[model samples]
Structure formats: C-alpha cells, structure tokens
Target: MEQTWRWFGEQDPIPLDHVKQTGATGVVTALHHLPAGQVWQPEEIAKRKHVIEEAGLSWSVCESIPTEDSIKRGDANARRAIDTWKDSLANLGRAGVPVVCYNFMPILDWTRTDLMFRLPTTGYALRFDMIDFVAYDVFMLKRNRASQSYDPLLVEKAEQRIAGKSEEQKKLLETNIIAGLPGGASAQTRSSISSLIESFQGIDDETMRGNLFAFLKEIVPVAEEFNVRLAIHPDDPPFPLFGLPRVLSTASDIRRLLAAYESPANGITLCTGSYGSRPDNDLVAITREFAHRVNFAHLRNTTVEPDGSFYEAEHLEGDTDMVTVIELLLREEEEAGRQGRRPRIPMRPDHGHLLAGDIDRQTNPGYSYNGRLKGLAELRGVIRALTRGI
Candidate 1:
C-alpha cells in the first residue's frame, strides 16, 4: 500500500509542495496540458517529474493519459493517435514513470447527478441520485428514447422529483449535469452531448468491448517494451450511462480484458468504489482474483440505495470492509512475493466529500483536501493495523 496523491499538474490549486506535506511519498499526476492525440514530449514529461522530485516526492503513477475520441470511435485518425499515445508512453517510461492509468468510458470519464448534495451532518458530498439522472435523461436533456433505459416506476419517480423543482433548480441541474466544472475531464454542451449520443446509436456493448480489445492489442506491447503498466480504470458508477455501453464494469469483464492479451502489461486500475457500487462485488474477493494484474487502485467506498442512487461515503465507513480488503491485498502481495514477482501497487483516496465549510468555496467536488486527508489517514491506519502482526 504505497500512499500516492493525485495531482492535476501545475494548475492544480493543491500544489506539489502541499501534496508532499500530506505525508505521501508518491505523486500520481499527468501531462494534462498536452492534447489527447499528441505525443507527450520527453521534455514535458521530465519537467513534471522534476517538479515532483524537487518537492521531495517520487512520480509514481500517471493518473491518466486520455484516449482521444477518435480512438474510441476507431476512426481512420485513431491509428495515428494511438501511435502518438505509444510515443508518449515511451517518453514516460524513459523518464522512469512506472504506471499509467486510463479509462475507456465513452464520451465522459464519470457521471454524477449532483456535485453538492447537502449531507445530514451539514457537510457536502458528491452524490449520484438515479431519479435525478433519470429526470435529466428523460424530460430535461430529453435524449431520444431515454425512458427505455429506466424502469417504469423509476421513470415515474423521476417525473415526481423534477416536478417540484423551481426553474432555478432545473437550470442548475442541467448545468451541473452537462456543462461540467472548470478542470474536470468532461466537456459536453447540450448539443454536443446530443451529437455524442447520436454517434453511439449503432454501437452496442459487444462492439465497444471489441474496440477496447483492439486498443489494448495495439498499446500493451508498447507498455511491455517500456516496463510501464497500463491499468484501465473501470467505468465509474460501474454501469451504463445515457444508454451508452460500458465494457469495464464487472469481475468477468476484468477476466475477459486480461484474457484479451496474455501480457501482464494489459491490466486493471482496480477501483473499489466503482466495482463496489454493486452489492455483489466482494472487494476482498476481487483483489484476490485480480491482484497480480492490478497495477493501480482507487480506494474508496459508496453507499448504494435500492433504486441505483449512491453517494460517496467516508473511506472506511461504507459497504466496503476496508479491514478485510487491506488484509487480502497484503495476503496477495505475500503470495506473489513467494514467486519472486513482488509488485507495489499505487493507491490513492478517490472522490472525497466536500467537508468542513469547503463546499461553498468552489473546489472540485469530492476532491477537496480536508475529506481526502481524512480518508488517507483512515486508510493508513487500516493498513498499519492489518500489517502489525504479519
């Protein structure tokens, strides 16, 4: 359990020095200024890594190197784009960055209905209210045949939820739902979102998975050559969104993904919060089953309601049993060491709440320092306790 903090680059309000002060030795960051289809210049990679090293932190993982829309579409331009991506990986590997995390969720990285759900304790947290999402999809954004995606009772409930809102609430929901925040990865104007949905009309889950398999076949060899582990993040919410297909959401999906290529370079990000959104995904079991190929981890929890609504719960407080999960990770690491192939997985606290008067101050929802500091502290304690008698 190497502690790493996600840094968004030089523009991030939480600077590199601030991250070092959090007692994390590793920095998880990206070359965000570079556009999606271009190769990350070696000079640029060196510059960011030098900054982190100067702050007395090791550059441990690449939080992302975004896959362009052309790649996802498998358009003619995608071949050149993936070549650029390969060049970028070579640059990062040459600079000694060991892990790269990326996701294939089409058009958007993650989706949430509300960024500031006022919690019962007066703090604010990011929430995914399924009914509100349904309302937006059905009557607000009004995607074609969006009603088919939700159950009849759920659609009726969404209608009720939206009916009571004033005009202001409706506008805010639309803005938060589609317009996105300042530095967040998604950019979707209403028309753009509509166009994006239209683009996915003929692509089903099978086709999307096939595209991803083709992608890994092209990229994993580069990763292998450079000793960089490319870890694909599971779909956030771990399910379909806006009627678009999600290929990386389940344990079986992970099995299939690894089976696509026999290379260890084709691996997973192993996001517990994403997979744990469904009650059936046992976190301990998942770690044991996929531990060898898990190169990165987003350790967090979610509290799911019956209707598919969920909210980010405190790191050690939700449905995921942190104690058991930590123990299992340690056990797996021990087993791997016996085979003389010990791997150190990089993990960070994903999606913390906006607590302690921070919600009104315009921070990235679930990315404020206070909540993540709390989460890291708790997870650190859990790791400490689990490893004490080993």
Candidate 2:
C-alpha cells in the first residue's frame, strides 16, 4: 500500500516538511476552509496541489468533498447542494486528483467523549465511553428521546456520570464532544448541534438509507464522468447517534451501496477505526469481500468494549486484526498489479496516541506529531516484514 498523511494545509502545526519526515509521499486532505456544499474552484485545488508537490508529495486523495445537510435530509435544497458537490468533484478531477472521500451521516463527522483519555503505559488516546456519551446526550445536550437510546441501567449510569462531574469538567466534556476534533468534517456549538440533532426526529433508519441511495444515484455518474472515485467514508462508531440513523456501518451496507450505482467510481474508504468500532465488522473478511470496490483506506484500530464504547488504540494493538487486514490489502494490490490496474490503495495512520513530549505540548487533539510518527514507523515495519516474507 502507498503511505499517505492527512495534511491540514498551511495552518497545520505539523507542517508538510514534518509530514515528509514521516516517510509519507502522498497527502490526503481537502479545502477545509470552504464551507460544505460549496464548489471547490479549480484554482483552490491547484494551490493546494502546488503546496503538496513543492513538499515532494502528491495530494493522493481529497480527504473529503463534504455532503451537504440538505442533500442528506432530502430537503428542498438537495439538488443544488449535490450539484455543487458534483461541481467540486469535476474540478478536482480536472486538477488531476482522482480520489475523493466523503460521508453521508446527518450530523458530526466523528464523536468521542474523551480527547485525551490517559492510558497506563502509552500516554493518551481518543475515547468514547458510553456513560460519558450518554451523560452528554441524555443529561447535557438533552436531545429528545436520548434516554431511550440506551438501556434503563445505562441511562442510570449516565445520570451518575453527569452527577459526579464538576461544572468545568462538564463544559470540557461537552466542548470536546461537540466543538469537533482537529480536522473534523463538522462542528457546532452546544445549541446549534442540539438543534441539528433534533431536526432528524422523523427520519428513521430506512429513510436515511433511501436518502443515501438518492445521493449516490446523482453523484456516482458525475464521478464516472470525471474519472474520479467517490470513496464514501464509513460512519464513525458504525452506529446511530443523537437519534439520527447511520446507514454506512456494516458490510451489507457497503454491498447495498455498491449495488446502488454498480460502478467503480462509487467506492468505499475502508476506515478500520470507524468500522472496527463495531465488533461484528470483520475487517479482513470485509476487505476480501469488497476488495475491488475500495479506493482508499484509513488504517487504525480501537479497543472496543462489548458495550458500544471504544478508545483509539495503537495502530496494531487494538480490537482489529491489523496484520490480517494489511495482508489482505497486500494480496489485493498484488492481484491488481498483475492485471495492470491501480496496484496499491492510498492510506494513512488514522489516529495515534499522544506519547512523551506530546503529552504536554499544545497539539491538535489527535494529530500529535510524535505519536503519529511512531505509528507510521510501526506500520512501515509491518509493510516491510510482510514484503520480505512474501
């Protein structure tokens, strides 16, 4: 697989030079400054591309062309939003960036209750504790019917967790969960996010699935026209949240989506951390099953509990079978190589633990340099070992 890093352009604390030092030759990013559903003018794409090339790296993937809320909810502006999204894809393709990652979840890109949950040995990792989340949902954000989402016992525990916190701690918890993580796709304050969550009260899982299909039906053809691969990122946590339905969480979900368009341009960004949050999503099997449909990858792991909570783990040491997953990807690449097709998928170290000097420095929540460097080094070792044996 080709190694890449997610770069946040000029403002990133870990600049492109530092990314080059990590042995990543490609970058996965987007015009985060642009609002969702707006056209990505070719000039903007070229400027970002120029910066990456100057740093001796290619912009391998546009980490996203964000889906508009109107499109996801099938509101009146859906057509205009999707048209803008398609326009962005066409311009990206024109700029010679072929792969674009996107997501369809109604609200939030990814949610975690703890940004720096301390570990016994390796420092801190991003975490999602059910109690912490439920406390926010039921007691803090006070989303409608949030209490019903959890079991009666879990709801009680949420109450206890909320009761045990200081006011300052409660505010921090809410901000971490809602203000969005570093480089997150969506962000809002407590009032705005709560209202956004409430807006989807009438939309059920089936309706959400239909909306996703409606989105793919319109955009997939544009992707094909531009020769761009639309790699839809799996819903983080792989489940519903804030009472909103999440469609792209399981293997069957991808299969259904592939069937929706039945084209190579319609692809999956197989994020291990996102799908791996669900214990039932066998990463190896899913990799094999959807080998040809995958256009991008985000290789990371999580230590998930039997309950829905999980925390980011060392790239290889979490709940996922990282070895088998990478082995499968290598096998897929090898097969593609013999067929004269794109041989390797583009991937990055999704998230890394904060270690050593990083524990004290003010770094982007999960984009700490030292930890990701360690992660990329470890992953590169696995790639080399597998190659040597082969």
Candidate 3:
C-alpha cells in the first residue's frame, strides 16, 4: 500500500507542506477548479503534479475527475461528457498518474445529515441520521413522492422529527444534505435538487444501471489504452436518496460493474466506510473477492445503527475489522508481486474526526488536518505491526 492524502488543491486550508509532514509520500487530488465534462488539459495536470512534487509528494492518484450527471443519466449530453472524460483520462495517464477514483451517484456525493456529529470523545465525526435525512427529504426538500420512498413507520418518525426541528435547525439540515460537502460534484440548492431529481423521473435502478454499463463500455477501453485504472467509488451510505437510483452500492452491484468491462483498467475503489454503511455488506469478503480489481482504497471505518444511520468511527474501531482488511490487501500486494506485477494500491485515511484545535479552526467538514493525521498514524502502526515477523 502506498500511503496518500487527499488535498483540495491550493484553496484547501491544509496546505501541501502539512501533507508532507503527515509522512504520506503520495497525494490524491484533482484540478477541482475545473468543472465536470471538461477535459483536464495535460499542462494543467502537469502543473498540479509539479506542485505536489515541489512539496516532496508524488501525485499517486486522482481522487476524482467528476463524473458529470449527463454521463450518469446517459442522456443526449452523455456522448460529449464521455468523450471529454476520455480526453481527461488520456491526459492523466500521459501525466503518469495511474489511478482515478470516481463515483456514479446522482445529484449528491457522499451525503450526510450531520457534518459535525459529536463523538463521546468530544471530537466531531460525519454522521447520517436516517430520521434527519428522511425528515429533510419528505418535509424540507419536499421531493415529490418522497413519502412513498420510506417505510410508513419511518415516514411517521420523520414527520415527528421535522415537527420538532426549529426553522434554523431545518435550514442547517438542508445545507448538510444538499449544500455540498468537500469533493462533491456541486453544491445544490432546493430548487436545483428538485430539478435534478425530476430530470431522472423515469430512470429507475434498471435504467440507471444500464446507463452505467453503457458508460463503462465506452470509457473502459480508453482507460486501458491510456494505462490508467478507473476505480469506481461505491455509493456513500450505500443507499438511494431523494428517490435517485444508486448503481454502485453493494458487492453485487460491484460484481455487475466489473463484469460490464472485464479489464484491469476497470476496477473499484475499496471504500470501507461507504460499503460498510450497510450491515449486509460483508467487508472482508468484498475485499478478498475484489482484491485484484482494487486500484485505490479509502481505509476508514463507521459504526452503523439498525435504522440505517451511521457515524465515522476511528480508523480501526468501527464495525469493520481494519486489521483483517489491511492483511488481505497486503496479501494481494504480495500475490501481485509474485506474478511480476507491482500493484501498489494507493490508500488514504478518509473522513477523520475533528479533534483537538481543529474543532475551532476553519476546516473542510470531515477533512481536518489533525484528525486525518491521527488516522494515518494509526493505520501506519497497524501495517507495521501486521508485517512484523513476516
């Protein structure tokens, strides 16, 4: 595993110098200033790479190169979007970046109802409260047919939850749900979200999955040609929201995705926090099965509740057996080495808790520096311990 850190470019409060201090020699980032569907020029890619190199860090992976909504819907604009995506892929490969981690989630990306869910340790972690999300969906955003999306009992609870929220609290909930967190495709307003959902009116899961396959069929070949591995990130929370269809949420979904284009370029980003959100997803099994296809990994953990809500947990302390997961990944690397392939999977500590002085400073939600540094240190310790005496 090559340790990497996700940086939001120059605008990120945590600068590249700070990243180098964390002891992660690789940086996973993107040219976030560029909009989706636009080609990332080779010069721009080189420039960003130069910046990371200057900081004594290599640009190991592109965290994302935003998969535009048009691509996800497979609508009229999808052709243009796919072409531009290929152009970007070629540019990135030419720049020597190997992995690209992207998601196909419509509208929102890695959503949560609470961005600052305080943990028992007094540190804040990202959280998805089912009741809060449902309440905001059915009552706040007021999406059409939203009530029909949830269980009757859950709907009742959401109604009660909404009734208790003050106007200020309701606004906060709306912001957290749609106003966008760091690395999301875009920040959306209520009207924008409604329009986006309406745009996908007739597109159900089957239609959405078909669109994703169509995308892979066209793009995977280009990725393979460019020597770039396309790692599709799983749907955060691993569930549908705002009645939108999610194609990459479970192990079955991943199986279908990989089968769509059977090539080394086509792979998955193993995000434990995202896939582990669902109790039914066997994280260990998923890792072992997809080890060969894993181009990148987000090694984080989460504590799931029975009601579908979950909170970011310490890197090694949640529902996931972080040690076993790391052990499997190590074995994969060892096996690849034996086969004359040096596939060093790039991993970063994701969605860390807001601890110490980071709580008072202005920081991207779930991306505070001190918090992630703590996570990386812990994960590094695990790797060392597991590899000891081997």
Measured by TM-score, the strongest candidate is 3
Sliding window of 10 residues with minimal summed lDDT for model 3: 179-188
lDDT by residue for model 1 (198-313), tens:
87788888888888899988889889888899899998878888998889988889999999998878888978888989777888888888888888889999888988888888
Residue-level lDDT of model 2, residues 160-250, one tens digit each, is: 9899999999988887787453334254567777678777778887888898898888888888888788899999878878888889999
Candidate 3 local Cα displacement, residue 264, angstroms: 1.1
Q: After superposition, how far is residue 210 of candidate 1 from its true place, in Å?
A: 0.6
**Clash totals for all models, in order?**
0, 0, 0
Best-first order by TM-score: 3, 2, 1
Question: Model 1, which residues run further than 4 Å from truth?
Answer: 179-187
* Prediction 1 global C-alpha lDDT: 0.83
TM-score-better candidate, 1 vs 3: 3
Predictions: Cα RMSD each: 1.8, 1.9, 1.6
Output the lDDT of residue 7, model 1. Answer: 87
